[model samples]
Target: MTTDPLHILKTVYGYDAFRGRQAEIVDHVIAGNNAFVLMPTGGGKSLCYQIPALCRPGMGLVVSPLIALMADQVAALRQAGVRAAALNSDLPPEERRDLWRAIGEGTLDLLYAAPETLLRSGIIDRLRNIPLSLIAIDEAHCLSQWGHDFRPHYRQLDALVDLFPDTPRMALTATADAPTRGEIVAHLQIGNDDSFIAGFDRPNIRYAVEEKDNPRRQLMRFLQNHENESGIVYCLSKRKTEETAAWLQDQGYNALAYHGGMDKAAREVNQTRFQREEAVVMVATIAFGMGIDKPDVRFVAHIDLPGSIEAYYQETGRAGRDGLPSEALMLYGADDIALRRRFIDESDAPDTRKRMEQQKLDALLGLTETAQCRRQVLLNYFGDACSPCGNCDTCANPPERFDGTVAAQKVLSCIYRTGERFGQAYVIAVLLGDEDERIARFGHDRISTFGIGKEHDQRTWRSILRQLIAHGFIHVDLAGHGGLSIAEAGRRFLREKPVLMLRTPPPAAKGRKGRAARGGVPVSLDQTDSALFNALRDKRIEIAREQNLPPYVIFHDKTLIEMARTRPANRADMAGISGIGEAKLDRYGEAFLAVIAGHQPDAG
Candidate 1:
């Protein structure tokens, strides 16, 4: 029952020091002040509130967005020997009564509930009578309409400020741009000096984008490097998710499909398997990954382009949450770009919102098409900057550039000559002098720009057109079924003839040869250590199965990797490992020490 933060951190969470701005934010809340925290995923955000709650006198009330996330956090806290419980619809009546009894007796340290549950009349009335340590709003960005994932229920949480006038309030989120940040601060009434923005950077993640040429083969190549690892494959449609999962399953992968179209019970089952098993790959649409707390996802692949950079960042941030190496590969094409634009143009949002969405989409396209460092562009979007990170694909293999003034001019003139009423396929066909009946009927066969771009192949022309759209030299006509039209920039390019450099079309896929072809964040263990790591994982899985909990809830892969390398022989040595708190050391130290003692290294 100590109130010292550092003492609590070392003995309770087993961390030697706080990461980044966690200590400052934690101290601010502990001093009975409201603060807004913007830290990246896996940046130890939970500690900013959890530590303060432990140091204060009363129970901490956490507002989370998902039931699964709440349950996982409660389980992890319980493992650390903290009194934590979650209130949700899934809890049985008897269990709910028990939790309420503990609350009445001042035995619970932290309580997690969804925003909807907290706003209920009975729940609010009961909570008002108790002493509150802090009111924490996780995923606070959901309160803003400008955020990628907006929930109407979150907007109602502003009442907490009035209901608990004297208690400290903290709002935390991992993904929020300037506008979204502003909206959150205004709605929550956070003080200007109290806002702390730990920069939005996950340096362990390697970013790579490839043109969609035989997407299945490209995805397969990416998957080869991540064998038997947990990951997510994002698609744009429910049917595509199911198809991709089935295809991966056919190819001997443990893949599952998830989307809004699936039955609720079926979705729950699939999600459970994904959480409990180590190697499950969830092929899902945007519906699958808002509040997933899985810590060891090694990769995230996108078969289609996401709507904006915010969505992409939030989705990819789900990987490598345990701070190990991870990869994010996105397969994009001109068609994906067109489809995304059409979705924006066809939506019923107001003009201002649509324009903002378009701008966001444009920023994402810039990131995808940039010949410079990918990390630079991504960080710059969130008003942060970094030097050329050597981890991204562009830094590993810099794209070759060529003067593309003529190519730009030819594409622009073709769109105009064809009356600006054709999509990329037809425009590229006219450029390459194809013998299609549509081109013949349009009499574009005799156009002056016809066959001018035949020097480049179809893939090359597709690349060129996609860059044009991304750069704002051209615009998509949603009314004309994604026809191309010249923007003012394109008109200026034609009139003024500026020098333009375009990236060379990447070479044809050679298919990854083996593990030797892997790049970006080397694997943590060598051959001998890998065998021991596997053995430790097997032991963890066995224990987790017996306890009916996810293996990560038992111990993260990072902890197991540490054990494998250090070969902790006894309880004292095991307790010195990073994640092994006093409680876990008492609960699991002997078992893990036995694992290390029993392992037999390969002789070869």
Candidate 2:
């Protein structure tokens, strides 16, 4: 009757109002009902379990895949004054036993563990003895054979649901197509549990796709669009990860590479460095995205196409977690698909696995080929209805598609006139009326349509080629190596009629630095007391150093920056910054106030 949930939310978690159905989901879990939560990246999935853990009489057992993810979540929870600990391989036996004792003694409210360990002998019974109230599965889709990221350990987790049938359980994921969702429920053996689908509209995440050409340079250019913001760039290979990280460092960006190929200790070091350090961009492969709990990542870029749309959605969801505007840019080519296909085809996976892999590949192909609003296509796969995001590249810049009957003739004529023996660059040069050495050597200057489309610039011609390939209007002969061949769509465009809507490239990003200019925390009030903010941050670091704790343990970068801007003169005014909870305010409040008072009087 008193809305105890609202009181708990504001006082315990510091959120004045619930985001979306977070309060409802917590209410459901607290009511002792099993729930399946399908929320987007920033959708507050943790609260479903965390809040329930606090409300329920006993501890909650959270099954998670990544140790770093579990550790980060535990760190954040403990920071907010919750009692949490993690059991993982990284913990020494002494520490693991101590943690187990804490859980048994009821000193811990939540405990996180990997499935591999949970499935180990005697762990389930040990958990039963601790009076667990709920069992939550994070990244629950990994149980799906239909998913890109399936784990045998997750298959073993189904045993837990049967063991704790009476106990309410929650399974959560960010990206699960319908098939994967069904697999998660069935695999978890919670077929009758309620499922909640938070809207998949990552409205704050602007999605864009760029055709691959000098992908590393394109990545650099793209990062420049959102400069100085923290982001993640996913690559297909470890070599590229290292190289890209190095190149970004050369350009004066704080970048680091992470991959499975590295030593375990080294990977852990880099991951810690990234998590604890602010504005450190981690260039890693798919492995890096899975267990990360960093909430402030402003962008996610794929230097290569993810293996499936499911994978793509999950990777991109990692951005915009703070619910502010963010960007997800994918630079892809057919070769990326082929490489993953080759890996799958050549692997020793069983025939069933191969078939599943093929189906996943087909879904990705459908996504790439469809000219429909990408948001519509992406959401449709999840059985959700959404209008075109109107902000995506496809919707905003409606490509100037012609009934390629004319330009196709120009393209095909240039190809035909030059005997069709060239790659895209030479062909584009011919179309652009470039009288270069290559054109003369190939005698393309003598072609009929050589200068016909001089009205269009080279970039426009390139975009046309990209759309042609994307729209099935042209084919790049992978076997002919790099030669362009007219496909049936191209033939139709040339002889019959094919409408092509050309998409205009977005304008250049302009901002303070070379980083991405698109996405970040809102510049609502110009939080740029840069000198004062820097000074406050220095004080926070000095205090953290003196206390021998991580800087975040004192106050996160965001909290310190907020104090610098608000310049709150008193304790009451200091309480409004995000992440500055009562405990943090009481512990470090006076110091922050002293710094702010030293700078100036109350501005807010």
Candidate 3:
């Protein structure tokens, strides 16, 4: 067995080198020191602990939060020929017995358990006898009360330090701002000096935020380019998830709905099908995406605004896990913004927590309404400096901004004139001179602000309103039936009449040209190589189905692309590919070699 992390990485996991801080973190762990890692998804955070576990003396204990995540990690590790097992409530009795036997015999290289399961007296007793090389708390942000995915059980994990006094511990998460990061460190008892913060920028993901107008049609248009690709469409409500899933199914697309409201068996089935099949779209609420391990999800679309920047980053991080080009689009309306504000105000959290959450929401809203590069704004939130990425929507079709002091004044005047008691729809109706009975009864049709905004359409005015709310010039009054109310900034803006520059949304694309306008994935392979890649993909899928495993567990698309480009001919040639580990070469080299040599069994 190789003791060198680099050698173990190549011979087992089959990667050439560590990415970013992976090598540093691995060395820290191998030296029997603790670590704290914050790396973006697809940044290979797992290798930091996995490599060290293989090089160290005993099995690595991974504290997983979800059963599905645990199973997925164990499967992937086993496929790489590492001795791994996940002990969870989902395991059959016989399987649990076998896992315990393996643990007692010191036969496993890694063991994954949820926080609740690991804290049990029985499991704790067993772990005390078994030597642990290192303990890795995956998704450590869950321990933070300030984090979006806070798990109560995770708070008890501080006891791990006391129980395993001699073992080095690592805490890791993908989405944590400074406050949340500090909370994670404190809760996990990890040293602050050992923290490794990788850049939060997922450069491969093209960020696009479109003002909502005809949202269903706009979503369909965006999905056109992603046909035959796996993606996720996030909705704010469970009802929306079901409706979107059904509507997409009616449109001849394979779609599934997932949410916490669904039956456990049903949700599990949908998630399983999504993982096992290709090109499946999952329309889901916020309940679906924590600790997901799917690597080939090509896109993630948001039909509504997410609550906070942290939640948005963590959710969008689900796409393009294989380092391939992927896209994320957020379609939000003024209504969505108001609704999110209402939800925040109505939450049972403490005043300080709510204030922090409100700040986070403001940051995300600022990103959506800004004319600057979306990537820069997102990275800046994580304290990472970024240049304008030419791949995002704002970069491809930069929106124009104009002096909107008059528009801002007009919006403020309308709210003031309407008694600040009406919601955005009624307010917009009054602005657009709609002859609604309510507007007439409230005498809003006679107000000086009525019809003054007819120069731009209703959509334009709504965009302006959202920008105002985002900038803190206005706020939603949840107690007043989701009505719009002027904030201190709005009063100051009206009195000061500052020059307000608001973004002018780009005109909607009329045809299939939208994809080209959005800047697509760079093709790395020529036509001939591409065809070979598809053939290799088919073979991998067939093998995956036979083994009852996700295709990526066999080999990621990145690995297959390399194989197609090189066109390896024999065992030696196959072994040279980036993802072909020694174990995989012995098990699959001959089959993949045959496929590359034009002897594919299924290429009739």
> What TM-score does each of the candidates earn?
0.96, 0.83, 0.95
Instruction: Give the per-residue lDDT of model 2 (tens digit) for 1-604.
Output: 1237666666556667788878888899888888889998877888878888788888889999988788778877776787899888778889988988898788888889999888877877788777887999999988887777888888788887778888888999888888888888877766554888886778888777766767877787777766556889999899999998999999988998999899988998888777666667899988896777766677899988788888888889888676666778888664565456566777898988888876776666666545567788788777777887886767766543344446656877776677666667878888888879978887768767778888677766775666555555555655566676666756666776645555543333333133325223333334346556766767866875675444555665566657767788787887777667676677777987887777673433
The superposed Cα distance between candidate 2 and the true structure at residue 328, in angstroms, equals 2.5
Off by over 4 Å in 2: 1-4, 191-193, 213-217, 333-377, 385-391, 394-396, 405-465, 471-524, 527-536, 539-566, 576-578, 601-604
CA lDDT, candidate 2, residue 50: 84
Candidates in order: C-alpha RMSD to true structure: 2.2, 4.5, 2.6
Q: Lowest summed-lDDT stretch of 10 residues in model 1? A: 513-522
Error of 1 at 510 (Å): 1.3
Provide the clash count, candidate 2. Answer: 16
lDDT of 1 at 222: 93
- Could you give candidate 3's per-residue lDDT for residues 48-79 as a string of tens digits? 88889999998999998889888889999998
Could you tally the backbone clashes for each prediction? Answer: 0, 16, 0
| Per-residue error (Å), model 2, residue 531 | 4.7
Residue 294 error, candidate 2, Å: 1.5
What's the lDDT for all of these models? 0.90, 0.75, 0.87
